[model samples]
Target: MKIDENVCWGIIGCGDVTELKSGPAFQKVEDSSLVAVMRRNEEKVKDFAERHHVKKWTTNASEIINDKSINAIYIATPPSTHLQYALQVLKANKNVYLEKPMVLNSIEAKILSDALKQSRSKLTIAHYRRVLPVFLTVKELLESNVIGHVSLAEITIHQSKSANLIAKIADNWRTNPTISGGGYFHDIGPHQIDLMVHYFGEVDTIIAVDLEKNTVSNDVVKGFVQFKNGIQFKGNWDFNAEEDKDNCTIYGMKGTISFSFYGDEIIIFLKGKQERYQFKNPMHVQQPMIEKTVGYFLGKNVNPCSIHEAAVVTQIMDVFCGIN
Candidate 1:
């Protein structure tokens, strides 16, 4: 693929994620340039633009979307605003790189999907796990049948409340159902679910046991999903736990594959031996996502997670949230 060397980029929201990691990634990616940024807070927008050396900053999101100079727009805002912002950008004929849990519900997902179909602009969701080296290795190993005929898989994610920034924000968007859809599950579960579907193919059925009282989310949740390939998966998310563990184990007839998110490494046990694979440091996984998304937009590659896959994920999450 020939690099265009002239891809101008704009960030829709200058939030913590953009400032800490994604902003730098956009600037660092080859053939990509961060030209503009938008935020509701004028001072924050100006500060971010100055700090990042962006050419333009505005509080009006439409300015970035409608700007003919910008070829791609990154929607780093919350899930609730994703659909609207994406549609507006698509309408303006700008490529979109949206954050995960693409929208609050499947309906919004469909709306965005339909808009993308009509517009010349392309869409890519921020499922960063797909581009991570360790996870990519896992995908390769599974494809190679290292774990012959995966039968069952389990994923457990535990995090301390002390580290939860969303919990500390007064009237945080993440806690509000209108903004974030649900709580922890909707916020972070998309990564796990997307990875599961990415490896195992489409899910045939899903049954969720959400323990929260007000339809937000519980400290613990257990879900069972059956994939079309007859692979059964059990997933759990525990937010109120003291010790943190983010790992997934896939079992098969021949061997097993295990991975830890914190370590960014994979462990494989096969044929009476165990081996480990470690990924590179300064693991800016988002860079790959940005590159691929740009490729997809420029008709160089396919959108890895299509609307159908995103809709399936939304359906499963809705069932988990007990939303009809």
Candidate 2:
């Protein structure tokens, strides 16, 4: 069977993520090629192009969006800038691989959803966790009924500091309620919430508490969501923790599944037998996301995480942040 030609990729906001991280993955995926990159700083864009062996570089985001040769665009810009850039790319009729949290709230999420529907441009959110090997294994195990009926789940992500490069990029935008939508809850909650909704189903109700305010507003948030299946998911994010923790525990009638985000390893204890499973990190997590998203855009026989699911996650997050 003859394979279709690789899809040419253009990256908007070529920063640290594009260079040390996702940029390399774009080149690594078999059916995808990094053709062009854009950054406001010409020096950064040039350096990225040279390091990645990309043929084209531009300081203008629109240049990449408008290039007929580029079939897909990745928006790695800050959450604050996601909406405008995404709209421009959609107008240009290019598939979009958007960074996580989709957008600030349901309104922006709705706007982007409408744009995708109207333009019929392929859209995929970069909720990389959904594509991780361990997480995928957990999903499969849950569906396979090794755990019987899932009754409750707890997901916790504890980071020592909130002030990182991405946080700095989002500094002004993150603090401002107008731009960021909310703080850590809006930023990182999408990942955990996506997993919860994916495993369970629609959320019926949610209650949240945010304990901080500032540029990195909401240092901590704890909330519970009731899924349509009557399963309860309790999630917590503590930006002020001393050590980082990214793990989830699911409880069911027959067993429990526990896993961490960093290692892509899962442990299942069912009816007294303990089983541990491990899988290689697929494309460093983020790259597989890009590749799968590209395949979805190219009409290949691969399924990308649904934007409607992401929007629901965002909606749950909005409620968790008390935004609406």
Q: How far is candidate 2 from the true structure (C-alpha RMSD, Å)?
A: 3.2
**lDDT by residue (tens digit), candidate 1, 51-116:** 989889999998898887888899999888898899898888877888888899978877887888
lDDT of 2 by residue, 140-191 (tens): 9988998898899998878776434134553355556566666655766777
Worst 10 residues of 1 by lDDT: 210-219
In model 1, the Cα lDDT at residue 20 comes to 60
Cα error, candidate 2, residue 296 (Å): 1.2
Supply candidate 2's per-residue lDDT for 155. 87
lDDT value, candidate 1, whole model: 0.81
lDDT of 1 at 115: 86
TM-score to native of every candidate shown: 0.92, 0.89
Candidate 1 to truth, TM: 0.92
Q: How high is the lDDT of residue 100 in model 1?
A: 83
Model 2 lDDT at residue 198: 81
